[model samples]
Target: MYKKSKIALAIGLSVGLATTAGAAETNWRMATPWSGGPWLERDAQMFADHVNDLSGGEIEIEIFPGGTLGSALKVTNSVKSGVADISHNYINYDYGTDPTTALLAGHSSGLTPEEFMMWMYQGGGVELYEEYRRDMFDVVAFPCAILGTEIFLHSNKRVETLEDFQGLRLRTSGAWSELASRLGASTVVMSGGDIYSALERGVIDAAEWGSPEMNRPTGFQEVAQYVIVPGVHQSGGFLECQVNEEVWTGLSEDEQDNLRLAGKLSVFESWLASSYDDLDAYEELVSGENEIVHLDQDFIDTIYEETAKWEDEYAEDNEWFARVLESQRDFKETMSAWPEYRLPIGTMGR
Candidate 1:
């Protein structure tokens, strides 16, 4: 009888230990607005995986693709409201909440991918982002991914010159919609999922989705004949990971550091992967049926002029907009010496 009682006590201790171990592991739901196959979705999964590894299995994040947890545009709100513990999303998706948010996501003829990274890590952009989101939405955000320039437009009709934009119906979002309207194009706002159908049915004449690799999986090539290049509107931008404030505050210092490091690593990985894949995807598109169109230098120059005007006008109204815009412009000016000092003439082969 004594031996049996000892054995039972040992079993009870084992069960208690197991329960405590399980309790120590933190599980989080990560929501994203991207569909399953794109690099954007891959970045989300990669960040989650990295977090799990970095935290040594203490943090486990499960990703819910677009529309699984909530509407694509509302995933950030889902994180804010605790429907999702975290979210991977473009910062501009929250443009309706504050127009300044769009600047963080990139703008027409804005920062290049490399310069944007410089501004983010070196120029205090990250701190500004954290402050802005925390004050406005009660969530914590980190830049988890960075994408190369997007395709300017995939169109059913040809757009060879500046005049071609006049009266054209275009599907776009955020500040680009306003910029497109300014250029005499009628702007239509819709989710990424709806763009293909709208173009197919003649509801919209053109749309700008993402980079070459990101757009390939959507099969825009099947329905759109003209693929415009030099995506001036969104030269490059960062995608962010937003964490619920309560959940973030609950994490240990080590766990929080792990999450931040994971985000930084994911950004580095995404830049290389997306840039390489874009090259392959661009090659494939050129070989396919779609006609590749490059915007003329004059057209691009005009866009740059209009963008500066629009930004200055916008800055005059909103305080945050003015602040962030000034930071970006200062960064641009500080880095303006790069071409003269670091690059050889023509910026060609080494």
Candidate 2:
């Protein structure tokens, strides 16, 4: 499903572009909160690469990592004001901007990344996206990369039940904060770089971050001594890349399609990379003598039940979120009857 019909023409145009010595170059700035390690940042680079190839070097994209331009919290405004031509940030970071955005980020556990695309592209999600953003802000955005489930809780102290979370400072971000607020733990949302210091200073006792692969670079093994699996808070989530409205509309159909196609690959491959990294990280954690604890099924179940309550309370306060949640639920209703229909079959590896 590549946007480009063939690579030969793109490459040919690119070659011609390289020969145009006096040609004025077109360059755009792309930014992401993640540094170069995780696939989130890698996906940004991939998008830039595709733009260059598809545009025949008529437009060049340069990527900035770890919010080099500014805090990840500011990326939305940054895109709107044209401070940056392109930027990647999770919808969770700005849920207050529009609580509906939380549903956009998959808090209700609706669509898997690929299934969500069906909802976004062919389904009405894409149209809704065009309507909402255009109405609210002048910028244009889409569900670019849909990041898979993040990692489970890994901590110095055991998380056996709801009581264990009480008074235990944990490092969490976005929607997880909703669960934490309900669980009575003082959850702190900090940049990835802050996890180590927070743990070392005893500012936090537990941390649940991205996939194991994504967190390995943070050296969690050296800090927190426990690892827990099956992150119930985030099943399969959506991550977006936003472009200035003017910039988006100016693209040729092929360029727009290329961006959409590249985004799909980025999210899918990011999930694959995460799985591989998690496997390897687990092995290293065990072999490297890091303490690894497997939460009993009961423990995980308790977490899920409590997490569900938080989600319910959340949706009650946010009507738009409720609407999006209901849509996905109805879609899933029919899916339950259709054996061939499932939640992100491609991701779960059926």
Candidate 3:
């Protein structure tokens, strides 16, 4: 009887250890800033799926969409406090802590979305960003989603020239808010979830979000009749995934490589996905009640000039901003000759 009891006890201990090991494998909780739309939601899901596949199911990331966990602006703090193991975030949202977040988030007017991504991947921007995240926020981050060129504004009133910005109550973020405020627009800071309600209630006259594809699902068109194109404020903005520093350090080197691969894959796939949606949405808006306004070239030039001036002023005061600006500008200059040298093959200058 004693021998039989000992064997059964040993078997129970083995089963308990197996169960605990399985439970320990899934170690991450990735939270999204907003209850994401299809485009954003797809990327998050893809990232999670890739990590799981790469780790052979040894690591699992559970996603919580929306401010379901907390406010978007508080994501950095949430990660720091380990309320979330990781988060899909926009560094620009945390500009209250460091104005340099605008530069890292790629808010400048000069580069195209693709060029901005190149800067991050090849032009030393990623190193600077990683250093900033570590030193300032004590978090680990990567440029996980490339939003590309965003729409300038969805406005209740048509905007054709610089003067149109005057006296309009607009919802904007980062340094663009300062520039817009200088141009006489009253800039209001609000989250994506709050934009429609704000517009519906006459609280804001205009708001700027990502590409039309990304914006259409938000139903901004139902509230605002005019769509401003050629996003001057957010030409090449992208989003980042931030992980708790402790959590990141605990990851295996192979797991780190897989995470980076997932980010790169999402960047390319997101642009491709959003392009189709944007074309379809653009056609629908033009064919329907909303009017698309292409800001005139001369007015666009003025915006470019204003943005240049803003960059200089910000760089002068913030050392972090200055370093990033200098690096991006250098990369931009190096790549300037390529487009001119390569002949346009399809739809060039159209």
Full ranking by TM-score: 1, 3, 2
Candidate 3 has an lDDT of 0.77
What are the RMSD figures for all models against the true structure? 8.8, 4.8, 9.2
> Which residue window of length 10 is worst by lDDT in model 3?
1-10
Q: Which pairs of residues collide in candidate 1? A: none
Quick one: ranking by lDDT, best first?
Answer: 1, 3, 2
Top TM-score model:
1
lDDT of 2 by residue, 153-265 (tens): 76888766567768878888776687677768888878777788888777889887776666778887687777765665665676777788778887656566656655555
TM-score of 2: 0.81
Candidate 1 vs candidate 3: the lDDT winner is 1
- After superposition, the stretches of candidate 2 with alpha carbons farther than 4 Å from their true spots are 1-25, 108-130, 296-319, 337-350
Which 10 successive residues of model 2 have the least lDDT summed?
1-10
Q: Residue 341 lDDT in model 2?
A: 56
User: Please, what are the lDDT tens digits per residue for candidate 1 over residues 1-350?
Assistant: 00112322353244323333454777899888877665445688778767765655566788888888888888888998899999898889889888888889888856888889999999989889888888888999989999789999999988867899889999999988988888889999988788889989999999998899889988888899999988998998999999999999987665666677778878887887888889899999999989999988888888888888889998999989898999999999999898786865335773
TM-score of each: 0.90, 0.81, 0.88
lDDT of 3 by residue, 1-350 (tens): 00112322353244323333443576688877767685346767666655555555556788887676676568888888899998887888888888889887867466777788888888888789888898888998887777767888999989988788789999988788888887788999887888998988889999997777788789999999898988877887678888888888887665666667656666766666766777888788789898889988877887778888888998999888899889988997899897788775346788
